[model samples]
Target chain A: EAGVVQSPRYKIIEKKQPVAFWCNPISGHNTLYWYLQNLGQGPELLIRYENEEAVDDSQLPKDRFSAERLKGVDSTLKIQPAELGDSAVYLCASSFSGGDGYTFGSGTRLTVV
Target chain B: GESVGLHLPTLSVQEGDNSIINCAYSNSASDYFIWYKQESGKGPQFIIDIRSNMDKRQGQRVTVLLNKTVKHLSLQIAATQPGDSAVYFCAERKGGSYIPTFGRGTSLIVHP
Candidate 1:
């Protein structure tokens, strides 16, 4: 079975520029999540989708960040007018349902200059 | 709000020895706990999980112990190997919550 997939394994953007990351979840998985991991820290949930509907997104920065799972099979995370502190590894994960073990993508390492 | 935190930032152990990683959580409502192992350049992979109702759960070579009274969690790896070197994180999910809160993480270094 294929694991969760993410594009642009690495991204570098200047401060104030815009950047986007994509994620493709595993087939038949009903839950998808976006997380941010800074250096020497564990992954923190940015948003969660339950079959195309965002169930939780309190941690996302509303001013410059947004995410969508239009079809529920894939999702996108965007950060506009990025800041240096936004540099981190963005991880995408999928699970069968709530509270299930997650299968994570390799992640996109974002570096804001 | 639930908060998961690791007791140590780093641990060094000799190969073939056992290693123990510890975590502390703040929410008494949290019922589900999980351990994840993340290698360099990769995301976290599930290692083992234990529910609040259960004190211990064992996987292939790993064991997770949870103490709800003190909100302490631990992962024990038997006969640790070089391949076991990685960052380990403990996460918790409350009874009615779907999103899990993660700890800061502990880096395990196994030296041969």
Candidate 2:
């Protein structure tokens, strides 16, 4: 079985440009998550979805960042007018439930100059 | 105020030796814990997890120990190999919560 899949393994954009990332989680998994990782830091949770419902997104920067999981199997994270600070790795993970069985994608590395 | 942090930023050990990574968490309500290993240019991979009800759990060559009293978690790798070199992070979550707080990660360097 394929693990979580993400598109555009690497992306480079100038500051103030809009950027988006796509994720396809493992089949049969009911929970999906989007995380951001900066250099020398662990991945931080940006948002979480449980079967199309975003259960947790307190850490997400609503002003510039938005995410959606329409079918509950795939998700997209968007950052409008991304800034230089937005440069990092965006990872997507899926699990059978809320607590365990998590599988992660290779992630999209975003660089904003 | 929920946070998880590692004791060291890096750990260097001989290829055949064992390694222990430590973490401290502030959320006493956290009942579930997990350890993840991440390599360069890749996302984190789940290593092992333990619930508050249990004190210890083991998998393959790795073991996770939870100490609620001290709010501490540790990962022990036996006979560490070069392949084990990666950044390891600890995450904790409470009952029914979908979000887990992650630590900064400890870089393990296995020397040959």
Candidate 3:
């Protein structure tokens, strides 16, 4: 089966610009996640969705970051007026459920200057 | 024996030797544990996983050990190869939550 798919594998934007990333989870998977991975560090959860409802978004920066999963199939993560600190890999993952193992996409590498 | 950032340890082993990587999980309530291998410019790929009820599990040329008492997890790669050189991370999932917490990852270098 095909794994989770993400769009725009790499992106470059100037500071204060608006950027968006898209993700499509695997078929039959009910859980989707967005994570930020800094250089030489593990992924940090930004938001998690169980269907269309976001179950965990405590780690997300609501000031500039927002994520939405519509119809429980596709997800979008956007950063308006992105800052230089937002440069990193944005990973999207999917799972059958909370207990199931996750499958991640190649991720979108964002470089904010 | 040393850390790069946030205890991101690095391990080096010969190709013909066995290699072991260790991880320390934080949540005692976590019931599922997984190990992931990630190459440069790529996302994490599943390696192996073990439940809280089990202490050890093995796969082809790979092994995972879970110690619930101390919340320690480990991955063993037998007959390490140059292809095994990458960053490995451990993740834990709680019984009722869908979010999994990930470790800082370890850099494994297999010398040929």
Candidate 4:
């Protein structure tokens, strides 16, 4: 079985441009998460979806960041007017349930100049 | 007010030796904890997890320990190898939340 899959392994954009990332979670997984990881820092939860419903998004920057999981199997994270500090790896993970360990994708490295 | 942080920013250990990574959490309501290993240019992979009900949980060459009293978590790797070099993060999940909040991470460098 394949693990979680993410698109555009890398992306580079100038500041103030828009950027988006796609993620496909593991089969049969009911929970999906989007995280942002900066250099020398750990991955931080941006949002979490449980079968199409975003259960947690408190950490997400609502002003510039938005995410959606329409079908519950795939998710997209978008950043409008991206800033230099937005340069980081966007990781997507999925798990069987809320408490289980997650299976992560390779992640999309975003470089904003 | 809830946060998880590592005791060290990096750990350097010789091959064949054991490595212990420590974390301190501030949330007592966190009922679940997990350890994730992230290689360069990749996302984090779960190594092991321990619930508040349990003190320790073991996996292949890895172990996770939780101390609710002190709100601490630790990951121990036996016979560490160069392949074990990576950033390790500890995550804590509250009872009602679906996602776990991650720590700052600790870089583990295994020497040959």
- Scored by TM-score, the top model is 1
Model 3 per-residue lDDT tens digits across residues A1-113: 76889989999999999999999999988999999999778899899899999988999999999999989999999999899999999999999874375789999999999
Of 2 and 4, the candidate ranking higher by lDDT: 2
The segments of candidate 1 whose C-alpha lies over 4 angstroms from its true place after superposition are none
Rank candidates by DockQ, best first.
1, 2, 4, 3
Q: What lDDT tens digits, residue by residue, belong to model 2 across residues A56-112?
A: 899999999999999888999999999999999999999988445788899999999
For candidate 4, the lDDT comes to: 0.90
Between 2 and 3, whose lDDT is larger? 2
- The parts of candidate 4 lying over 4 Å away from their true place are A97-101
| Stretches of model 2 off by over 4 angstroms after superposition | none
Query: How would you encode candidate 2's per-residue C-alpha lDDT over B6-35 as one tens digit per residue?
Result: 999999999999999999999888889999
Predictions: Cα RMSD each: 1.2, 1.5, 3.1, 1.7
- Give native contacts recovered, as a fraction, per prediction: 0.97, 0.87, 0.77, 0.87
Please name the candidate that would achieve the greatest DockQ relative to the true structure. Answer: 1
**Residues B2-112, model 4: lDDT tens digits:** 688999999999999999999999988888888989999888887888889999999999988888888889999999999999999998888887577888889999999
Q: What is the TM-score of chain B in candidate 4?
A: 0.97
TM-score for the first chain in candidate 2 comes to 0.97
Q: Can you write out model 3's per-residue Cα lDDT over B32-103, one digit (the tens) per residue?
A: 888899998789999998989999999999999988787778899999999999999888877876566787
Candidate 2 lDDT: 0.92
Candidates, DockQ = 0.83, 0.74, 0.68, 0.71
